[model samples]
Target chain A: MDLAAVVVYEILYTIAFLALISAGLAVVFGMMRVVNLAHGEFVLLGGYAAIVSHNTLGINIFVSMLVVAPLAVAVFGVVAERLIIRFLYGRLINTMLATWGLSLAMIGAFTLIFGPTTTSIKAPIGGFAVGDYSLSGYTIFIIASAVGVVLLIFGVLKYTRAGLIARGAMQSADMASAFGYDTSKVYMVTFAAGSALSGLAGGVLAPLVGIGPTAGLLYIAKAFITVISGGASVVSGLIASSGFFGIVSQAVTFATNSVIGEIGLLVAAVILLRLLPTGISGRFFRDRL
Target chain B: MTLNRRQFVQGASAAGALATVPSVAMGADSIKFGSILDTSGIFEAYGKPMEKAHILALEEINAAGGLLGRKVEMIPYDTQSNMALYTQYARRMTRRDKVDVVHGGILSASREAIRPSLRKAKTLYFYNTTYEGGVCDRNVFCVGTTPAQQSAILVPEAIKRWGKKIYVLAADYNYGQITTNWIKFYAKQAGGEVIQADYFPLNVSDFGSTIAKIQKAKPDMICAVLVGAAHLSFYRQWAAAGMKKKIPIATTTMSSGNEHKILTPSEGDGIIVCQSFSPQADFPSNKAFLAAWKKRFGHTNDIHEIAASSYDGVRLWAEGVKKAGTLDRMKVIEALESGIGYTGPTGKVTIDGKTHHVTHDMHLIEVKNQTLTIAKSYSQIPPSDTQRVCNLEKNPNDTKQYEIKI
Candidate 1:
């Protein structure tokens, strides 16, 4: 029974892991339709920011992750938007090319500054035993943070004025502009928020996994798969897709090993994409978001 | 402007001599030592120091009046941790540049990728990295300690100190796969048993389920054959789960890179490891090498086992060249096969001519507060694992890597 509990916890943790990593891309690519190929690098940047602040400046680890990492990446996102991304708006291929270049450049910069080895911070929380298995307390924190981030994204998008304006601007920019709202500013803030969310994921995961310059490659594919597999509506699609992929991957993983489990995930993605041409949200939450 | 045939022939002959002079004369007059390493990407942490060690050894050889009375020239290439580029660069070094001897290849995969090409080109190749044993190429000298040198000592010592039930966590590759066999071999020899052995790919960072599985199995200790930067997470994750207190860990793959220094003391402390070289080893040869490296590089922070092995490899090759008194490949191989030995940073390192592998004084060390402390020293552990399968003297044409099959 304890083994079963641990398995269930692991499944939930995997789901949370997917949701956290995909949330940023969901905002930028799903809602904004920006096609950010460098979303992974942005996460890497956030990881470095948190690590640098925590280790060098002696800031608290949580503060570094929660406050410094996201804020730093958000600032980077704003500058990136103004300098490069602003011009490539609406040009999908161009944005991809530009962001791909940006990712490479960010990786280079990271390698130059941080060196090749991974910089790791100690996990703040300790472990607790449930029956026969002793599980990492950090897992619970990650799941909680993932839930909080999703609800926060949902709340801001659905219940707030800025969220409403941002959604309207994304849906119909010229119409929103005619109604006396600035679409460009909204897009910029949304992109910044997206970058910030990526940073948060990176920061939260810093302790669980060490972050190197090229560490972003590990997450980029999985994040893109989750976000794209979710399709149009950002929050609903993210939650639903995270739920589906996370459960599938973890189930296979528990049944066998990680290698086959990863194969199972890609296979499931192929089958899922074939069946629901849109996504889970495209079918179920089509009218909600 | 109509030139006669004889005049044109004379002009062509002059150009031909000039073309031949650079390739033939340069090869004859200087020792071209080619080095290929991943100096930029993820493997740079290992590669940079190895590169520096190569430079340092070449510099020392040149200072000592060169090898065979000719100046040693180093031709270095950074493969940037790409596997395809390793073969590409190896070809360029061997064919285009025509380097006499080549050293460098960190991963076993990288070694295999370039080993065939180097053999085809007749370039003397040296792969100076710790790996699973049984590479029996006559033309190549693997300078790093293997599973025989590491697991033979580490597994038994761990069993003696910790307990008999061992849980194995290893990277999913040839190195990890074969090393796990050696660990099992040694564990059984010591009247111990492996409860569970898990294989994780180099890219797999999360060890949540694996850790739980290990705990459920209720192993007394863990034998971690994890590799690269990504696998460093196992230590962090293990510590985070408070497994550090519950169960101890021993590793054969901890110190080849900067993974030990990368982890915090809380995360890295009390892990048992067996390596051939450590900066903490107090020996004259080691001290001199460290001094020279510090002088050249301004810090000894980047020094690791592979780097030390690389330094030893270069010096060992130079010894063979000195004994043979020629830049000829076969002659040097014969001289090195006569069992050349050198006192290096890791102490007396001898070439096991039969297997074309190194014999080293393996150190049993423990990671305490992010630094390695030598607990006990074992001298001159031969590549017994490779020797069991590979006998180059009996079969000189042997070029196969014999994996240990249980």
Candidate 2:
């Protein structure tokens, strides 16, 4: 209702959004040891897809996610694996190069298709009014959906057969293959799922943020910051790092200007990363690493 | 990574050999004009259209009995929207291609990068886009509105029309920061105060926090300096936040009619844009220009404000060449410095001989429904001799304002 509440609301919403994106990237890097630079493009594709579906087909923004989110990530994952990523197994530099190339190509292709313009997807539920402080329905949905996804992923990886195989492959790919685990299929499925998570983040955030061709650059940096800050255990670490960064960014912006806020957060991120190479949460997941 | 003597010698020899070639020789053929554009990257929306306009202008110029009794030849290179590539391309154009004059650079950074090269090459450069000015080079002619031309005029009018409380939102780049500074300075001069100022990177998409801040500030009007497709996003988000009706939006860059092509009608409606060119200008030259552009591009309703300026740049350059009766860079520069006025599509174009900056009519346009209609036009604003004043001083940042004798 007041200024402080509004600032708090902004800080929380931003944290939730950032955490959702960073979670998928953290998983891919922490669990699979693949940087997946094209991860941001998957999000971009989802955002664009949401825009198209909403504008062209006149579908409900929330429902369009069902078609766009999974499809974008799956398409990227399949194509990436088939053309470039499959060869990058166990080679970090090669993986980085391949994914970086894929990122540039996708950015170029999307810009050509979408005309470098920023387009918006409508909020599914508009806004929920509470006294003088109104929260966007889309933001609420994003927060809820991201929480749901984090839980779902936690459940799948903790209690499921496929996730166990993924964990095994992540630990030692050669050993997992020697033990009759289909490491190739595991890699494909993990990449696809990671990409799908990114897409879901994009789809949900599309209404809240405008979709543009080069919009992924900042997010990619932010996601990396989250991943590195979170350390090796992808989900929880990334969530915590995202929250931390989001709060810092909001606080700085509130204190001064947005530009200074961004610069300050980035500088802080660099210093923190340097001091804690394994990251803030890396100590908790030492056994996993 | 160290180079051996033999390798260094070979590289030096190649460079020397390349330098010996005469770039601007008259071969009883077409006169070559160099163009550097961002065919790829974030600025492509502005760059591609500009390239198209340049080509179209060259075509029309050639068709109408070429400049200097020779058909005009355009040698265009894509910078890919990188500053390094822009410098490289500018060098290649002047040294390798031997273009008589150079035109292009949608972003101010690109133009700034190529300035030293332009001075060294002694090539006449026609900068054809709106910019934050304070630059005055003998070799360069700025064909776009300087901060004085756009913001100086817009801020006062905006403050008068929509109270004195203002919010300034700009892109976090050279153009944006400089323009915002100019706006702030002039807003204070006009007895208005900037309640808040914020900036976003060129590619920023989310405006929720920024809009929230603007709402809290409750400024009478918001002055935006965003460029390209990003404006569409800002407009939609601002409207969605319910601040569009509460605060009147005034922008130096975003209110251009070209934005309407990308944004929905509702998103663009009621925003006042201060610019040199508007698609709704009812001049005879503009009518002919629009018709020709539509015919060539086969796009009926998507002429950006920059297109007319670019077209005017080429036309003005050609006129200078004709008047000078030579392709000599110095001669062309002298002719352009004559402060000659030309009737073009956007309106009467006048270059300040002293500033090398073009001063023209500034249009205040409002988007009504879907079409950009001219709400008002401020014409004959005397071009400030800031360049002349600054040229005499060592530091351009000196707190001195040139008095207009008019």
Candidate 3:
């Protein structure tokens, strides 16, 4: 029936949303072991960058979201890694504290510029009819984007020399350095890549949520939940956890309403963590990335 | 003699006590009007304008030769959108600053947080924000449009224009919950049925699934009671899904914080929002108020329902003080209870002596190019919903927010 199709679409969209938001955190936390608490703020900055470019500079919405937001955030990521994150390397607790402070500073900086009001651009795509029901065409774009991003990450890590070097550096910096690789350069590039993914997620989701100074709070908890619950294997774990949480949340949302849906997602995450502390990937996808 | 530790502390304490005496004496020369609002946080959109409105009102009152030959001094406190600070500042304003009268509490929770303290201190409180109404406190005056004054008029009008199957999407809070009930009450009166009602927490901005759900229900119209910055997304997402053109929408909380301006012209246009005030209201006093605001603040862009109501609230309190001829708490209360009214930008806001609430004119407005265009005006709708439960005359000691059961 039309209802079933719409529900399935919603479930897929939710999964895509979770994956998109968590992809960057998975790379930074799971792969780098850095635990970037400012992951949410990085996403927030991307949204603001998209809005500023599209609304103020009169750039095409798609171009601003796709190119400008990620590039801007990637540049910031490089600077941040150089100035603060570099010194805090190999110190997990210190990185968390430093990133948390960075998050607060980003929020303050954003409020100074944007003045605490919600700002957003209109969704590029309009709704299209699906049988008897109509849904946002942007939903399809988001699902596709999520798929592309996951594949892109997977392809790079599985094939490219840079991705191989980055993975090797993350696994054993001493071994990679002995192989004549600059581990520092690898860390910087990996961090920037993670930040860019977060930016892309923020840009894609901007039309739905509208960007504000405190907007990061909405996605931070969910991103952390998804990434942490996914365990150590970045791509496979992110996919697995995002899939489980998103389906549970969206199905509950459809059955009841959004409040209970959110509660349901949180409850599922809690139970999942209790049962498998190392996460879904820890137990199931042990050797898969 | 060498000073011991206890004697040295006593000497410093005495000096501190002596320093406070002169400051307290200086403060007594002018009547202190305390204003508390969240001027620097997420709620700043609602708070900053309200603070400006209060200043304008106070300035106007003082410019008219000072109330009772004594200058009204403002003692403003920024609550910073924190509920705990509301209580902290309320106590400070009443006990430390000893303000004669206090105005400003943006959220209903903020008002509730400080209302009892103000009542205990007998500092004469005025909460000037549109909220769920059922407070029967004789000590406080609520000068905002309640559900009866808003939803009772908006729902029926929307039902008459659109079809009968009304879909409700309200925020998950007392304001949204109670307002949705009022909408239902009025919708039934107009022979309409709510096809579905959904509640969203203030932070849930994603509405993709909800949009699909709405399409499935196929309601004639959507009645939104959403609030805050996050809830603004529903409007954006609803339009993005191209549902705005297909189904008309009506809301009770739009334009209060200038939410219409936040959305783009295409997205916001054709949405109906009923409120107690509109900047476009054709009134001489409104024009003057806007002119004064422009002259003082350099722009009238931020003037909205709650801002305008805040202006009227301060003016009404000044009127009560002038009539009483003294700032005595009981005397001013008596004067206010004598049906004090002020005709300002909102058009004749009169205190309902019975419930200590206000009866004001409501305007049904449509958003056109990011501006509210007044389509129809209903005059002097009382807080009938609160009136049904609250009777301050009979039970003067009553201090409870009664939730109306449908």
DockQ of 1: 0.79
Please give the range of 10 consecutive residues that has the lowest summed lDDT in model 2 chain B: B397-406
Taking all chains together, the TM-score of candidate 3 against the true structure is 0.97
The candidate that wins on DockQ is 1
Q: What is the descending DockQ order? A: 1, 3, 2
Question: Per-candidate TM vs. native?
Answer: 0.95, 0.88, 0.97
Q: CA lDDT of each candidate?
A: 0.90, 0.76, 0.91
lDDT of 2 by residue, B1-406 (tens): 9999999999999998776644434433779888888877767777887888799889998999998789998888999878889888888887677778899887777888897787788788888887766665667777877676777778998899999999998888767787787788889999999887788886666666776677677689999888655445677666555555667888887633366655666566888777777778887888888888889989746567777788889988988888899999878877877777787777889877767777788787887776778888888554453453544224422322233211
Instruction: Please report how far candidate 3 places residue B29 from its true position, in Å.
Output: 2.6
Candidate 3 lDDT, tens digit per residue, B1-406?
9999999999999998886677598877888999999998878989999999989988988898889998999999999988889999998888778899999999889999999999999989999988898988988999988987888888999989998999999999898989888888999999999889999988998787898889889999999999888999988878877788889999998887788888888789999989988889888989999999999999999988999999999999999999999999999998999999989999988999999999989999999999889999998999999899998889989999888887
- Please report the candidate that would top TM-score against the real structure: 3
Model 2 DockQ reads 0.32
Chain A of candidate 1 gets a TM-score of: 0.99
lDDT of 1 at B96: 68
RMSD of each: 3.0, 4.5, 1.7
Q: Which lDDT tens digits does candidate 1 get at residues B257-375?
A: 76788999999989989999989999899999999999999999889999999999999999999999987899999999999999999999999989999888999998988888899
DockQ-based class of model 2:
acceptable
